[model samples]
Target: MPLWCHASPAAAGAAHSEPALPLAGGNARVSPEVSAEQDEEGEGDGRRWSSLVPELLADILRRVDADAEKWPKRRDVAVCACVCRRWREVTIALVRPPLHCGRVTLLSSLKQPGPRDAPLQCFIKRNKKKSTFHLYLSLTQALIDEGKFLLAAHRNKCGFHMEYIISIRGDLSHGSHVGKIKSNFTRTKFTICDLQPQYEGSKVPSSSCRPRLASKQIKPLASTGNVETGKVSYEYNLLKSRGPRRIRCSIRCPIEEDTEIDPRKAKKPSTPGSLVLYNKLPQWHEHLQCWCLNFHGRVMVASVKNFQLIAPAGAGGPWGIQDDDAVILQFGKIEDDVFTMDYRQPLSAFQAFAICLSSFGSKLVCE
Candidate 1:
């Protein structure tokens, strides 16, 4: 049995032997003799573990960290840290390393930053039965079994286009709707616009709750939009991949406010401040007969529905050279019908979400 499974027999015996300090007549007391015996046993149990040399404890924790690198096992490492102060310190030391990077990184980073603001974590869950998908956001790393009820996107199918009804606090039943994401036939481009603001305290929309741009249109401010007209405010473009059966995608946001197309240009002209999201395409395996994405191109067995957003390395268009070290956003598949998203500075939850939606559906039109 593992050390964490059950307490030492001596500790259990000590616990049972201790006198019950009960409150009676608004007073609580314990016999001095029993209290002293309890104290001695408690001290003995503490000393047994605490007496171990710091090096030995650290060695044990290092082994634990190495062993729990997978999904379910990783959760155990989190539980181990909560055992006691000494264990917590050791775990923190091993998990977080000194770094001179952005304020945020993956929680699983061995050299993660010290406790600061918790990074935003989002997951995509698709419901094939309903022909719909939902996007969820949470502050802590969690498995779907943990239940995510923060901000969410519920899908509504409309012909060739799909609409994502945005709601907050799990208001799927009767909550006032907040916004909608409309996906076009190209299946790459999407526009997010705010619906009417919910009246105070009522689940029903106010009489003015038309699907128009509210007085203050609400969307992820991370990526700005180029054009705004009535209820339709933001417009973003999802560029098609260059190769067939490729898992990669490119996104351009806040396209030039000027709508005129330059027919003479071979490629789309990138606007001055336009941002691009790039997905590193995954390769197909001959033996597995399935397309996959893996870290560093080695773990080919794992399915990868993931990508990263990057800015041009220098002054260039969306298709220009990319910086090798800069990673603005990171997202990938975590489990069946679920995916994980982690982003650094300048990327808002809403912007991260819009980029992720471009990942859905097949890009190959002819098969």
Candidate 2:
């Protein structure tokens, strides 16, 4: 029952790429119908669209949320949601503890633990840069819905605090692509890290080009960070591919620690770092999916989650991945039903990976 669910699923896909009202760096939510007329000299439509602040503001929030994983410069989605009165009311309410009945979005049947029954907040969305922690909603929660309609609360703890990046490479190095990730990621450690390049048009070398199905499904990993984050981590590298290449690095990390790729030090749009690792992990030819490992070096992602990785065509770059061959996670049983919680494995599932780039993870990089 989407705005146009009757239409083909492809139609929804079209909406995603439909020149979303041509918004720029700023989050300006102009109603689609009115946005086109914003530049016209005063008179009717221009003023009318300008007057419809609520509609425009909503659209702006929608767009900002869509790109939250990419151009991340803020903490609160409310920053985008509160551009207008209507959004402010909605966002503020969602953040309150013991969420009200109707403000939730994706939690269809999740049962929030009562203060007495609720588990102690084992996880917190502590935005290090923001100097705070958001223990309420999650990116998935926000993506599920922003409107205040459903009311049930679930017991979804904040998962890991990392993104699993799958990459493809074209640079013929001395070692083969298959290797242990421990040595590569001396400092950082996650389920999957950028190890190669992605393709744009064609698959690279032996790799295929298959964009991941739902990169957004990647869960966050839990973290009790150690003492090694201060080391000099090498910057992500970008390379131009001779042919098409694809890479799918999907891992679960945490939302608490905002450790993503910075575009300022990145190479090209194609040379995206931690940012692109979001839903756009990558997909490729046919239906081949990449892989990851657990702490004990056992493959995971398949036994637990419902996600896979793919590579886009023409995805290659100059720099090598920081943790190309990192270990995949070993997630225990997580009741799909958030209402009923379990505690077999890591309480909070955060995605991580080991790359050959720099020293990450702890505060004082011993290496």
User: Which run of 10 residues does model 2 get worst, by summed lDDT?
Assistant: 338-347
Candidates in order have lDDT scores of 0.44, 0.25
Compared with the true structure, what per-residue lDDT tens digits does model 2 show for residues 1-367?
Answer: 0010112344333333343333435654444344445435433332432344655555555554444331122233424232334443433333322222211222211122112121211112222342221112222222221222111111111243322121111121222121112223322333332222233443333213332334432112211112121111222323422112122343222112111122222244332222122111223335445332222221112322222121223221111213322112111212221111111110111122122111122322221
TM-score of every candidate: 0.43, 0.19
User: Candidate 1, TM-score vs. the true structure?
Assistant: 0.43
Winning candidate number (TM-score): 1
Candidate 1 residue lDDT tens string, 210-238: 23354844333222222311111112323
Candidate 2: C-alpha lDDT: 0.25
Best by lDDT: 1
Backbone clash pairs in model 2 (N, Cα, C under 3 Å; residues 3+ apart or in different chains), count? 97
Decoy 2 TM-score against native:
0.19
